[model samples]
Every structure is written in structure tokens, then in C-alpha cells.
Target: MGKSQKKRQMRRHNPVRVPDSHLPKGLEAASSSSSRKEAILPILQKMESVDPAERKWACVAVSNLIQNDPSTRRLLQGKNAVGALINRLSDSEEEVVVEAAGSLRNLCIDGGFDICAEMYNKNILTPLKSFIPKISTTLSEYLENPKTAPENAQKLVYEFADNVITILWCLSETSNKAMNAINQISLVPFLMSFLASRERLPISTVTSAAQCLYVLTDENPPAIEEVRSNAPYSACVLSIVQSREGLPQANGKNKEVADNRGLALQVLCCGILRNVSPIPPPSVAATVDVDRDIVMPTLEPVLSLISLVEASQHAQEHIAKEDAIPALEKLSLKHTPKSDHKTPSGLELERLEHKLRTVQLALEILTGVCATLPEPDFDVQDADGEATDADGDEAHEDEDMDDEPEVDMAPDNEAAVKQQSGSNATIFQTLVAPLLTLIQPTPLSFPPLNGPSPHPPTTSALSAIHVSALECLNNIFLSFRGAKIDAPRADPDSGRRIWDSVWQALGAVGTDIDNPGQERRRATWEIGVGVLWGVAEAHVKVLMQLCDAATDEGVKVKCIGTLECLAQHPGSVDANRVCTYFSQRVPEPLLQAVSALIDIYSDETLPYDTNFRQGRFLDALVGSVEGVRKAVRGIDRKKERELRVRGEEVRDNLVAFIEYRRSLGV
Candidate 1:
């Protein structure tokens, strides 16, 4: 009795521990602690349970565990959790299928190429595709009794459809292989159908469908062509862009949700347009007539939205500036200014950012179309009055160059149609006008230091609005560079105005300084320099101003670099016009700025290494100074003398700095 009692007590006190060898192959490696593995292994096992209820619960648990946590997701992947999930996608219980799909969707978030490749190899799309018809059927049935259908049922259907499309989106984004696989399944038409029937689908489904299309078509020419080939796709996109049925209200209680939904739809539409109308310079040679017709209608809504956002932002700033109490009045009447008057609401900022993105996408579409259009051809005649080819061949020699059937060098019919549609006018009024307004300086002065700053600045770094605007402006100028147009008499002034805004935006009150916190300033400076460089001939004055007025070393260096680029390579700018402008307008300020830069480099008091800084700033400066020296040699002998003298001084200073550094073994 004593031996039996002792044995029984010992057994009760020490429970048996399972060995790692007995567990699934990779389960032990999923987590560091044995106890954690023990906890998770049961759920993994239960996922394979014969009972559908247990499997459904397991799927939900796994889904939640991996939803937002990357480490847990990686661990699950290591444990072969994907194979289990894929198996459950075909589960007879609808709940299990939905949960498994949700789980897979979460895993695909930022999953990287390897995980996505594995999922693709597992034929994840087959199960995902299978769920579409099932969800569609359920949705159709639910629409019959929309008011009476249970909320859970509606949520389940929407979530399921969202998950399926989201998984497909992630897969398509992973690599070319996955995209091709998706393309083979006719995914574009599938998603386009969902987008077109927005009345029947939930907002979530419609958004996901659009997002899926966006991913599928992005940089995928064949997929884009597929979408372009679909007869109803462009109309569907235009419909979504124009629809106001479910738009966000300004003061609504669910403003954030409504705003997000609107933004999603807009972004999706823009993305489709962007892909279908490829941006230029890596020109898409294969033309799609569908995209040609879509350019203006797609832009109409986007540009209008941008104008509204710009107006609202202006109004908000106006209110913030005007609402302040004067300092003397505050002392006399003992009134305090409202603290909350300056900060914009989160929803307002989100809406503005969304609109900025739409504007960027719209500009991208315009840029693409402009790229597709033929450049204005100019005939070159020899001094002897004989026409020559680009290679300097005589007209008869050009005929011998390519004997293949002479392809029409004339502008395509699409270009003629675009002109007839007055797209250029619409673009100038809609896109260029509003963008110029954004960069234009306001009349309000900065308030006194003791008072709050008038026009409170946005707290965001590198605001999407400013960046997108700058990028769009750059693309417009670049695309139109050298292209002849029959634009109105004011068009040349429009170009000058663009230059004025760019200069003002780049060198505005807060931007000239070198503050790390002022990230937007840097972005503005970079993009502004790019735009000016694009239209260097027209903006020669702006370039001169940048070289003279810029105080930041980086800005100084970049401006010099841009001048060098202009002088060395005029790009699409008329070389004769550039030479004329530089000869007439740029020599004096350009030399002054260069002389100042030499003095700055020669200064010995600064703590930084001159040699190190020189490496960064000298090449561009030398190139620019020398370029100016060469350009004005004959036209302006006096200016040429001044440039040579300043340039020699800079070169001597730079050489002296290098020699001194080397002597010190620095």
C-alpha cells in the first residue's frame, strides 16, 4: 500500500512533457520557448481537425495572431502554416473558408517576394478564384432582402470578397511570375466587372476590386493592355470618378470612413489611368487608342477635386490668420486667442493628401499622352541650301538609310483628336492653374515674433501636396519641351508664371535655411531645380536668381550644377534660344554668384574641411563658370572677361585648398 501510494503521488506531481521530436517538423522552431510552442501546436493541430467548428476557431485564432505582427507571421511561415491555410480554403464550412482566406490575406501584407512566390507555387489563386462565385452568389441573394439581411452575413460576405481580392493583389505585386499567373486567369476582366457593378457590391468589395486592378496593371504593360482592351473598363473608371452618390459629407459623424472610401475609389481610378496611360521618357511605343480617349475625361474629375482642395486649404489658412487677437488688444481687454484655431483636423488633412495624390496621377496620365504624341519635326538645311537628315546626310542619302516601307512620320490621328477635343486648354486651366496657385506666394505677412505666426505651417514633412504638385509641374514641362502647339497668346506668360512660382516656392521664407527639420524645403528645392532645368531657356532669369539668392550650400551647388547642365546640354530646349538668353540676361548675376562662391570656398575660419566640401561643390561650379565663359566669349566680350577672371579666381582657390589639405595629410 505504501509503495503504490508513493508511486501514485509521484505521478500526480510530475506531469509528462512531450519531446520536440514528437511535434510537427517545424513547430518547435516557430517559437523560442517550449511552452509557447506547446500552446500554438494545439491550434495548428486543431486547424486540421475533422470537426469544422474546431477548424473555424483555429483559423480565426491564427488570423488574429498574424494580422499585424510580422514576427508571428514569419514564425508561422517557418512552421508551414501556409500549406494548412491553403488546405482549409477548400473546407466545406463557409466560416472556415472565410477565416482561412482572411488569414492568408494578412500573411501577404508586406510578405516580400519569397513568401508570395511560395503561395503562388501552392496555387493559392485557385481557391481564391473559387470563392469569388460563391461570394457573388451570396451577395446576390442578400441584395434581395437588403434591409432584412443579418449584419453578420453582410460583413462576412464583404470581408470574404475583400480578402480574396487583397490576396490576389499582393500576389500580383510580388513578381512578374505571379502577375503573369494572375493575367492568365483573366483577372482584369473579373475585377473590372466588380468595379462596374458597384451598385450591387459593398464599398469594401468595390474598393478592393479597384485596388486589385491597380496592382495588376502597374508597370505591367500586357496587363494594362488587357484592361485597355476591355471595352467597358474606361467607362467604368469614368463612372466611379464622376459618381457622387456616396461622397463624404463635410460634417458627417462617420466622416473618416466616408472620406477613406472616397479616397480609395479616387486613388484606384487614378492608378488605373496612370497605368493605362504610361508616363513618358521610357516611352510606351505600343499605343492603345482606348487610353487616348480616356485622358481628358479621367483628368476632369481629378483636376476639379484638386481645385477644391486648394481652395479649402486657402480658406483654412485665411481663417487661422484672421482669427488672431492683436497683442495690444489682448493686454487691454484681457482676451486670449483660441489655441485650437491653427491645427487642421485629421480628416481634413487626409482628404487634402488624397486629393494631392489624385492630382499627381492625373498629371502622370497627361504626361504619358504627351509623350505618346510626336515631337514637332524641324527640317535642317545646310549652308548650301540643301536639306539634311539628323545624321547630316543629304535628302537623297536619307532615302538610302532605311528601305523598309516608310512608316508615317506624321502625327497620329489620336493627336489630331486630342487637339480637336481642346484637351490642352482644359489641362492648362485645370492642372497648371491650380498647381501654380499652390506655389504662388500669399499676400499675408508673417506676424510679429511675440504673436503666433500668421498662416500656421503644416506639420508634415515633405507634404504630398507640394511634392506631387512639383512632380506634375516637372512632367508637364518636360513632356511639352520642344513640342510646338497652337496655344493661346497667354501661354508664354503661363510658362513664365510657372517659373516665378517655382523660384518663390524654392526660396520662400522658411526654405532657404539649412534646417534638418525642414524636409519639405529640400524636396521643394530639388523638384524646383528639376523643373527649371527642364525649361532652362524660358527660365534663364529664374536660374540666375537661384544662383544669386541661394544661401544654403547645397542649393548653391545644385544651382551651379543646373547651370552647367543648361550650358553643356540644352536637352529639349531650343539651343539657339538658350544661347541667346544666356548671352543677353545671365552673364552679370551668374558671375557675381560665382565670385561669391569662390570667396566662400576661400574663407579659412569655417570648421568644416574645405577639401571635403569642395569635392561636393567644385565640379559643378567649375563646369558652370567655364560654360558661361565659353558661351559669352564672342557675344559679350566684357562679360566674357569678367567670367574668365572670376573663374580663374575660383580655380586658384580650389587648387590652393587641395594643396593645403594634402600638405597637412588631411
Candidate 2:
């Protein structure tokens, strides 16, 4: 029969599978029933073999077996596989050392901080440090003249370097001692060497090097100084960000498949630049030059990546909606348990995760870019309660230190640079709208079904993006409010426009209030309060107004909670000292609002329903009152006597309320 006739004839036969079809009849039985330790014990024994080949094979076996299998990792560790691997690092055979380092690196990654710490205690760095000079020499020779090293040898050397540097990177994250050790090894120059020849070295090697530098430089003054002072080092990092030639394109056939490694390199480079930028604004010159080079170029790609990911997410959601099985159809027919084909593959999920991480890194860079250092305190106190001298020495000198008058404007060239180099204000203004879009809840795009449905990749990604954006926005809000970055007189609307966008964005809490993701929603709201706290001098008025007008108890609680945070924090959560600039210099309206809250909570005449529960709210109220009292006490005796008088009344009312609550025991 012809093809059509055969298909019709086949349809007429039984639709079910035959008893002995070609497909596997049953699930595969366990090949071996050995327990975890029993399975790995032999391999551990082989690692100590006098034969180098056996030891190399054993190291490779340990690495392959422990690849993300945490139980296997623990079992191996119990059998002293870590020490075995460290011993192999000093083996006579080069192959053994390479495989050994590879296994240890895998342990650090799979075992996390604890394993890294254990490795450090076991002196993993002692042997790993020995490889640094070798890595530097081999990679240097290969990069300088590829012909000097054979292809296989070059690959092996690069592989060894990748593993060793990665181990150091993992250790550096564990503690200060590990970081100090990595720093002392003069690893920065070697890391810079990788960045300098990124085009020539293996991508994995370059990535490990970048990853090492990214962690090493973070909050490390020594690393930061070395990186910033070396003009060529910074240039190498900047070049990686600037050149987009080798990066994977967004419009490729597999759109979800992102070039995560390349994107990670960019994130590292951005972080390095941020590390060197002197975030608390020690001096304008130090940051301005780096910002000029870093911010604008870095921003364009960051914004573009955000837009790309968002568009991709929308497309995925639309596709998911179209593909969702209809409810009536699902009920009428028998449905099979969701198989692998029905959901995104594991690789696809990984890509989506990486993309989300890239977005987070981008937002963090912006947050760092917007941070401004607080001004220096002229009247500094020593820890021993001794007065400091004019030259900033301490010997119980009771001297009054006069504050320097604020400069209305910087030098013309410096001011020009600030305006052009994406200043904190400019960066804040540019990022606010886009970031606002991230915090709003994403609507449910798939059909609600009784049975388990395919998990969309964007669900967790969206939440992550929201939290990251909220954090970035929180920083921006504080940067502008705390910096008081003055705009020119000719442009009155600049500040107004920024604040308008801020309020409007804060109001865009999405409509999916009762969804299953309410925990994330609550977190979103908590961070929203933090953003408002950033500009509390102005936003507190709005929050109080909301508190008065809103009928929702939750809404009232949030507004009140935000006010309490504002009263305590000097500006943002970062500045939580007893008394500081924004703390001692709180707005008059905030003071009144806090005092009013204390009085309302203290009064017994008001019905219990008129006040919220006296649990966490009471604690927060007491803390806020205490914070205000501390702020008043911290003030110089010569200045601001009115706050002290107000503080005393607030304290008495707070004390009475705690006693009253205790008496009722409610």
C-alpha cells in the first residue's frame, strides 16, 4: 500500500503498545547496591597508590563522582579524600597534580564555605600557592608566543592554572585570613596578567583569574590600591567591558542560551572598577576619573541586558499561556504525569538563572556607582572618652572643633566632570524608571490547574530581579538624599522630576495580592519601606498621610514601621550609628510624627482597637523612642536644646506604655 493507505491501516490496529515492544521493559535495576562509603572507599585507597597513573585515575574518579553529589562529597571527606587530594598536588607526576587540583577545586565549589575553610585549615593554600609561579610562567609563555607550547601541553597547563586560581578564589571568600594569604602571595599581578592577555589565554583561565580578582578586590584596601595604581591593569579590565566582538549574541537560535561566562567576566570587570572607585566619596578626584571611564559605558550594556531579558521573559510568558492545556479538555481525558519534554530542560533553567544573575550584578554595579561617602566628622571622639586634638590626636583635650564651610561648587573642571561622568544624581535619575518596572509583581501568565504544571523559568528569576532592583533603588534613594547633590538654579524641575518618579514607582505594587507568592510580596513591601526611608525627610510626610487615610491594617502597619526605621537610621540602613548627620539632623516633621506615635500608643483612654497589637509594634516603638533619645544625648551641648526636651517627654511616655502593657499582660 501507499504511505497514506499504510497510515490508515495502522490506525485501525491496536493503539496501545505491544507486550514486548522495543522500548525498555522496566526501570534499570541498580548496577551495584554498595553504600556511599563502600562505593568511594576503594577510590580513596587508590589515591595513595605508589603508581602515579593509579593516583591520577583515583583523583579523576573522585572529581567525577562528587560533581554536585553532596552525600558523595561528605562520604569522601570522611574518608580523608581531601587530604588525599592535597597530597596528590605534590605528586611527582604533572598529570597527578593537575587532576588532584581539579578534585580539590570541585570540592570547594560543591562543599561551599565549610569545605573551603577546612581546606584552608589543612593548608591547601601552601601547595596551591606553589602553582602560582608555574601558572604565571606557563601562561605567560603561551600568551607571549603560542608556538612555544604545543597544543595539548598548552591546554593542560591552562587547565592546571584554572583549577589552582579557582581554589584560591574559593578560599579567599571563606575568611579574612584566607584573603590575607592570597594577597600576600602577590597574586594580584598574576591575575592582572590573565586579564591583560585575555584574548590569548583560555577562556576558563581568564574567567578564573577574573573571578579571583573580583573577590580579592572587594573591600580589600591593599588589592584595591594595587589595581588602581596600575594604569595598565585598569585598562585591561576596561577593555573587556568595552569590546563586544566575542560575546554571544542575544538573537542567536537558542535565545535562552546566554553567554554566561562572558557576561560574568563583564560583571567582574564592573565590580573591579567599583572597588577602585572609593565608594564613600573620600575625594572627588579619585572617583571622578574612574567613573568617567566606567559608568556610562557599563550602563549602556547593563540597560540593554535588562531590556533583552525582560523581552525574552514576556515572550516566554506568552508562549506558556498559549501552550497551557485548557481546563475542560484536561478533565475530559486522562492526563499523564508531566514528563521531561513538558518542562524546560535543566540546561535551559541554568541559562535563565545565569541571565538573572547577570542582571543582579548589573544592578549592584549601579548601586555601587550611586553610593556617596559621608562627610568627615570634625568633632571626633576617642574610644576612651578622651577629647581629640585639633591635629586629630587624643589626650583628653577639651577643644572645640569648628566645621569647615561647605563649598557651593567644586572647581569648574571638576564640576564639569561630575556633570558629564554620570554623577550619583544622574545615575539615579537614569535608573529609577527601569528599576521601578522590576519591583512590580508579574501577573500570572499560565492557567490555574489542579494538577502539577510545567514550571516556568521566569518565576524565581522575576522575584530575584525584583529584590535586586529594590536594593539598587534603595541605594539610589539614599545617595541622592544623603549627598544633597545640588542641581543648578536654572533647573528647578530636576529634583522634582526625580521625586515624582520615585513616588509613582512606589505606588505600582502589582495587583496579584492573594497569589501564592505572598512571601516575596511581603519582602518587596519591606524593601519598599527601606526605599522610602532613604528619603525620609520628604517621604515620611507621604507615609504618615497614607497611615491616616488607608483603611487596610497592613497598610497602616507598613507606614508606621517605615516611620520607625526613618527615626532610627541616620539615612539608610548603612548608617545606623547612634548619632550622625541625618540622625542628629532629622526633619522637624519626622520628630513630631514619632512623638505623636509614642503618645498615641501610650494613652489608655483610646480603645484597644484604635491601636495596633502590642507585640513587634510595641518593640519597634520602644526602639524608635530609644533611638531618638540616643540621638538627642549624642548632640553637642551647645547646639539643638529643643530636641533634648522633646526626647525626654517621648522617653517618659514610652516608659509608661511598656509598664501599662506589662500590667495588662495582654
TM-scores, all models, native as reference: 0.54, 0.58
Return the clash pairs for model 2, or none.
280-373
Candidate 1 global TM-score: 0.54
Q: Report, for every candidate in turn, its global Cα lDDT versus the true structure.
A: 0.53, 0.57
Which portions of model 2 miss their true places by more than 4 Å?
Answer: 1-38, 51-53, 244-260, 278-288, 303-353, 373-425, 436-467, 483-529, 532-538, 543-666
lDDT of model number 2? 0.57
Segments in model 1 whose C-alpha atoms lie over 4 Å from true places: 1-84, 107-115, 133-151, 214-426, 433-469, 484-529, 535-537, 541-565, 569-577, 580-666
Which digits, one per residue and each the tens of the lDDT, describe model 2 over residues 257-320? 2444676687668777777765333333243455556554554345445443454465465545
- Which ten residues in a row are the worst by lDDT in model 2? 1-10
Per-residue lDDT of candidate 1, residues 1-666 (tens digit):
000011111110001110011122443443652323443576689889998877876676665554323345556777778889999999999878887887777566434455667898888988877766776677667767787678888877788888888788778766767777777777776677678677776766788888778767766777787766654676567566556444333333333343455555754675576567543222322233434444454444444443433445554655554422222223211232221122244335434434444444444444444444444344555434566543335577565667777678467866775674464455556667666655433332222223222222222211434544566666555444434432322466777677677787666535443442233456566766777665554454465567568777567556555554554432332332223333232334454344444443343433222222323344345446455555445345475677566556654554564455446432
The candidate that wins on TM-score is 2
lDDT of 1 at 491: 61
